[model samples]
Target: MPLPDGNNFIEKFAKSFYNLFDTPATIIKEKIVAPNQKTYPWYHQKFRRVPTIDQCYTDDPICVFEADMQYRRDRQVDSEILSILRQRFEDCVLYETPDHMEKCKHLLQQYEEGSTDWFTKYGDLGAYHDVKVAYMKQKHRMVWERRHGPVGSGMKEN
Candidate 1:
């Protein structure tokens, strides 16, 4: 009989191995003594810099309130901009046909080859922006794959 996919074999092996030692490993780990919380690196690095609620009380409470309100407004504006960009990015990817993808790739090549005004040549700003974003995302993926091997090669997860 023909063998199943390679992933199936690996999954089966992993499951069998886990089943064999899962209980014993848990028992051993639980029985071992854990180090003091103060000795842990993250405990000192994270907690030492944070101020408690009582520590935040100040003589000029109005200034603190105003500062907090400004901070919240800035965060809200940032979140709105991020949401817009995400929508644009998704629309660019979702609506791209194979021909459009190829054109975007060619435009990227032209831009890389000293045609700095490639976007202006496209006329429509929305189309130009979408193509540029798609090209950059593709380039990023290519570079990542080159550095770390193909997806699911046991180096990085999906």
Candidate 2:
């Protein structure tokens, strides 16, 4: 649903920024192909030949408002989806979580259809990729421990 009075940016941005930066290594790609927020980060920051952001700031304002609103919605949706994926990744690491936790069919309907479930799991604020990697290492260590039975246990190999 559209914003009650009109679309707003900060409100929408707050709900989506976390998922926007999940891929720390490829922040630009993540922003460009944000799935929902497809507007290039460059688009916002780059100076435009047709009109400057300042020029467009208060011109009509509604159009700008709508555009900004759309941008926020897109980013929020993208971030929410990515966040769900991130959470699943973390869960997989800590709890040996399995794959295909849920299908996308239930996403907009179940997740952001006024649900916007990202708030509950938003903690430390930067654990997506790092948690995923650490989890991988955890599983690796578990496997190694089982095979070697401790590094200094004298389980020598020829």
* Runs off by more than 4 Å, candidate 2: 1-58, 97-158
Steric collisions counted per model: 0, 0
lDDT of 1 by residue, 56-135 (tens): 45575654554444434443455555555555544554667555565455444433432233322322335323333433
Cα lDDT computed for each candidate against the true fold: 0.50, 0.50
Each prediction's TM-score against the native? 0.28, 0.25
Q: Per-prediction RMSD in angstroms?
A: 24.5, 25.6
Cand. 1 Cα-lDDT:
0.50
Candidate 2 lDDT, 26-98, residue by residue in tens: 7765665565663565545442334322334554666555554443455456676777765655554455434
Q: What is the Cα-based lDDT of residue 155 in candidate 2?
A: 65
Residue pairs that clash (backbone atoms under 3 angstroms), model 1: none
* Poorest lDDT segment (10 consecutive residues) of candidate 2: 46-55
CA displacement after TM-score superposition, residue 38 of candidate 2 (Å): 28
